[model samples]
Structure formats: C-alpha cells, structure tokens
Target: MSKPLEITNLYKRFGGLIAVNDVSFKLQPGEVVGLLGPNGSGKTTVLNMISGALPCDGGSVRIGSTDITKMKPHRVAKNGVARTFQLVRPLPTLSVAENVQLSLAFGKKRHWGREARTLAEEKLAFVGLEGRGDERVGNLTYIDQKRMEMARALASEPELLLLDEWLAGLNPSELRIGIDLVKNLQGQGMTVLLVEHIMEAVRALCSRCVVMSAGEKIAEGPSAEVLREPAVIKAYLGDDHA
Candidate 1:
C-alpha cells in the first residue's frame, strides 16, 4: 500500500499576520506535489509547520494516518517525514560522506546504530556524489552541496521528503540533474512536497500542485491547469500572466 500525507485546515499566525490560513492538501506515496506561490505567500510557513519547526494554530498534519501536527521536529521526522532547508547547511569541517553518515543516522530516529560506513557510501552513490565522499563538505559547489542535502535527507530513509526552493541557485544542467534525482526517488517509492519559484522545474517535476496566495490555498489539481489560475498567475507571474 502506498503511504500518504494529509494536511487539514492548517492555520499559522504571528502577531497580526496569518502566514498560512485554512490550507489543506494530501499526497500519496511516489507522488510529487508542488507547493507554489510567490515570495511571502506562506509556502515555507506550511513546510515549516509540517516539519515541526513552527506550531500550527488550527489544523492537523498526518503521514499515513499518523498525527504529527503538534509533534516536535524530531518526533515528526521519526514518523517518516524529512525536509531540506532553503539554505543548505553542510558541516564544513566534516567530509562529505561524514555529513551523509551523520544525517542518515540522526536525521530520523535517535540513530545510535552502527556507523554503517558501507551504507553511507551507498547513499552517497545513490545521490550522484559517489567517489567524492572524502572531500570536505565546504569544498563542494553550490549544486553539489544541495545534492548533499538531498543525500542527507534520503539517508534517513523517510517515506516523504519536503524541499524548499531547492532549484533557486542551480544552473540549468544542475537543475535537470536535480529533477532527475527527484524522479528517481519517486520511482523508489518516496513521496515529495516541494515549494519552488522555478516554474519550469515545477512543470516538469510535479504531477499535481497546490497553489497559494496571501496565505491561503486557492487552487489544487493538475499542475499545468493550476498554473493558469488567476490567483496563481497574479501572485507568481504578475499581471503579465494570462
């Protein structure tokens, strides 16, 4: 059976600002759902709440029937959800393989397991970073660093992955590679939820998408059609959008 993710009537507020309002969505295993919106449109807020970095005021988040809305980040992660930050944060001093080793072990359940060096190496190879594990993470290029983050997330073996603006800094080839990586992960049965500004990438990678504007979900469905939505266009493509 495919694992699924569900978000119900989610709400997040800070002072007078409602960063996310009444947002709800769901995803099945092996699905890639794009969470699309312009800047300050609450996309990251939703991801943060799912990842347990922020508290939701009025809603629930669940992965395969497990309620994770109010759980701590660690607890939520242990329930089989993992996320990558907009700013890639690899340990500069650690070797690339070491970074993956640490996250694969600690990213989910309180690792304390065997170091499993071979497993770490295999994960590095899985993410297209094979043979480079001996290099310090600080020395990798921007795109390579991002791939390392993906590797780290995958190392935990989560059923679901959340990515925030992952393509923002990549070159064209790198973007293609990243999309291919996501596709491969999906083929391996991992679900993905991504928040992105890169429309072309969104069009290529997502099977469906949820569109947000001013902190609310305005549209959700097939990616191509949803991108044509007026709210999605105005918020993301400006008045020039059709």
Candidate 2:
C-alpha cells in the first residue's frame, strides 16, 4: 500500500528572516497540487525543506507513517521523492544518457551498469530525447536541457514529484508541450507539487492550489476558486490579473 504525504508546522529561517512559517499541507495520493506565491513568499523554501535540501527550523514531515523530517537529501530521495530545480542543473560534461543513468543509480530502486543504461535510455525517450541521449547536456537547447532535468528526476521513479517553476520561460508551443508532459505524468499516477507563476498552466494541471504570501499560506482550495481569492489576487496574481 502507498502512503500519502503529510506535512505539519514546517518552518525554515534564514537568520532574521523566516522563510517558511508553520506551513502544513497534505497531499492525497495521486493528486496534483499547485504551490503558488509571489516572490519571497516561501514556496521554494517549503520544497527545499520537504526534499531535505535545507533543514527545517521546526516542524514534522511524514510520508505515510514514516517520519522524514530530519532525513538527508539522498535519504529523502530514497523514500520515494524526486525534484526538479527552477534552474536546470545538468552535469555539463556528461552525455544526456549518462546524467539520467546517474539518477537511476542513486534513485529509490537503484540500478547500475547495463541496467542503469537501459533504464536511462527509456527515460530519455519518455521525455522526447530518445536519439539524442549521447549528446552533451551543454550542447542541448534550453528546452532540451529542461527535458533532461525532468528525465533525470523521472529516472528516480518517484511517487511524489516536486517541480519548481518547470514551465518558466517557455514559449507558447514549448509551454503546451511542457503542460502535456506533466499531464502525462499525472496520467501515469505520479503525484506532483508544482510551484509555478503561470496561471494558465496552474489552472490546467492543478486540481487544488495553495497560495502563499510572506511565508504563510493565505489561500487553499480548488484551483479556479483559489486563484480568484482577493488575497491571492493581491499577493500573487495582482489586481490586473484578478
């Protein structure tokens, strides 16, 4: 049986600044939720804490009944979590396939040698990079690099996927493709926590949304209803958008 994610009273501080303040949310299995906020609203901080990239100041994080609040990043990854960065970070010198292979080797179900390579090829194809696996990551276009980032994360075979601004900076066509890719993941039963400023994408992909402002969650509900809230309009979508 799979467990849903539960976060309670999560907190993160940077000296005098409280980046995330007593935040909590529960992700039902197989639900795509949007984490939305204006700049400095602590959206990324929550993700970092959940993914174990940053230690939380105070709070509890649980996957199913397992306590993962203090786990290391790799341990978190091993616990069925995988994430992609807002800024894609590929191993510059590694071929695209090699990069995905590295993720597979360290993922929840670890693979190695020939098995890793075979899995890496499959993941690349999943992300539309099939025949280009041998190309150096540094040589790929920005959109392709983004695909590589997603492929590497998918190689981990996570039950919970944290995507931070994955659709940022894409043109209309690319944005459509990116949205389709995320939808495909959802269709395959992957639960996603997406942090994106693109309202169109959010409305299309998120069943529910959590809106943040000044390190606190101000609104949470169905995507369309949440986006129409006055607080969300003021803090994130802006009056013009509202």
Candidate 3:
C-alpha cells in the first residue's frame, strides 16, 4: 500500500550555515510532488534527512503514522522508504543483481536465496535491464547504472520513493524514457518526492511543487502555478525573471 509522507519543522545546520530551516510539507498517498531549488538550496539535504543519511537538527519525519525522524538508513528503508541518491552508488565488486539483492535482504519485505535473486532480476527488467543481471556494476554505462540504482530502490517495494535529480543529465530520448518510467511508478500508486532541475520533467511529472531557496521554502502549490510564482521564478532565474 502507498503511504503518505509528512515532514514538519525540518531543520539542518552545518556549523554556522543553516542548510534547511523549518521546512514542512505533506505528500498524500501516491502523489508525486516536486522539490525544486537552485544549487545549494538545501533540496538534497532534505532528502538526506528523510532517508536518514543525515541527522535532523530539529524536526519530524513520518511515513503514515510512524515517526522516522531518528531512524538509521537501513531502518528507514525497512519502513517502506526507499531512495536513489543524486550520485549513483553501486557496489563495484558485486554483479548488478547482487547489488539489488542487498536491498531485498534489508528492505521492508525480506527475501532470500532464489526468491531474492528472482525478485531482483524482475526489478532490473522492469527498469529495462533484462538479462544483464550478471554483469559487473562497473561495466554498465552511466544511464544503465542509473537504471540499476533505480531497480535496486524498487526491489524494496517501497511505499514512498525519493528520487534526487534522477532525471538530470539524460539526453532527450533518454529523458523521455526516464519520464515514462516515473509515470509508470506513479501509475502503480507509489508516492514519489523528486528533486529535479529539469523544469520540463518537473512540469510533466509533478502534480504539486514545493520550492526552496537559500534553505527556506519560497513557494508551494500546483506545479504550473508554483513554477510561475515570483519567488520561485526568482530563485530559479534570479530577480530579472521574477
């Protein structure tokens, strides 16, 4: 079942720099929401906190009714939250399938042996990587590596998927494929929170948007309207655009 994500008063600091400040938003079950911001806007920091890769200085993160504010990364994954990092990280020593198996072993639903292998391959195929499960992670192309990372995330069968710029750096054709892949996930009722700079993809995929600038939320609403807001425009294209 898809789960809702609620973040309230989320904050983070690095010494004197406040990376995030009292940010809050809610994602209803199966809704795809865009997190937009320019470089250093703390969008990635927010994802890190939500995935337990970074500790929150102050705030609350919840999946459905369970609090996950302080959970470890693995524990957060076990609670139906799965994410793809901005930088793809695959186990270099392992085969593509094995990398995905790690997620299956530790994800919300635990699988083992042939079951895990079978499920992992199924996910790979779902991401358009059929029959290449035995290949080394290093052997795949950049886009293929991204596909593998996504397959690994999906192996967890997560209720909420966090995608951090997964659509960036794709060629036009590849971008279309990426967009379709996200659409497929949305169609399958997976709630998604994506941080993307590609305005086209953001406009195509998200029903709603929450935009941040300088660690503070500047706009939130329907994707089209939010993208047109003065504050959001200023954050992305500077004062001239606004």
Instruction: Quote each prediction's TM-score.
Output: 0.94, 0.97, 0.98
Which runs of model 1 end up more than 4 angstroms from their true locations?
Answer: 107-115, 239-242
Pick by TM-score: which candidate is best?
3
Candidate numbers sorted by lDDT from highest down: 3, 2, 1
Compared with the true structure, what per-residue lDDT tens digits does model 3 show for residues 124-172? Answer: 9999999999999999988889899999999998999999999878899
Which is superior by lDDT, 1 or 2? 2
TM-score sort, best first:
3, 2, 1
Local accuracy by lDDT, each model: 0.86, 0.91, 0.94
Q: Model 2, range 1-242, lDDT digits (tens) per residue?
A: 23588999988899999999889899988889999999999999999988999998999988888888999999999998999999999889899999999999888988999989999999989988989888998889888899999999999989899999999999999999899999999898888999999989998999999988999989999998987788888885577766
1-242: candidate 1 lDDT, tens digit per residue: 34799999999999999999999999988899999887888999999999899998999998887899999988887888888989998888888988888866665554443554666778889888889989998788998999888988877778889999987888889999988998898788789999998888898889999988899998999999998778777877678774
lDDT of 2: 0.91
Those runs of model 3 whose alpha carbons end farther than 4 Å from true positions after fitting are none
lDDT of 1 at 35: 96
Q: What would you estimate as the lDDT of candidate 1?
A: 0.86
Better of 1 and 3 by lDDT: 3
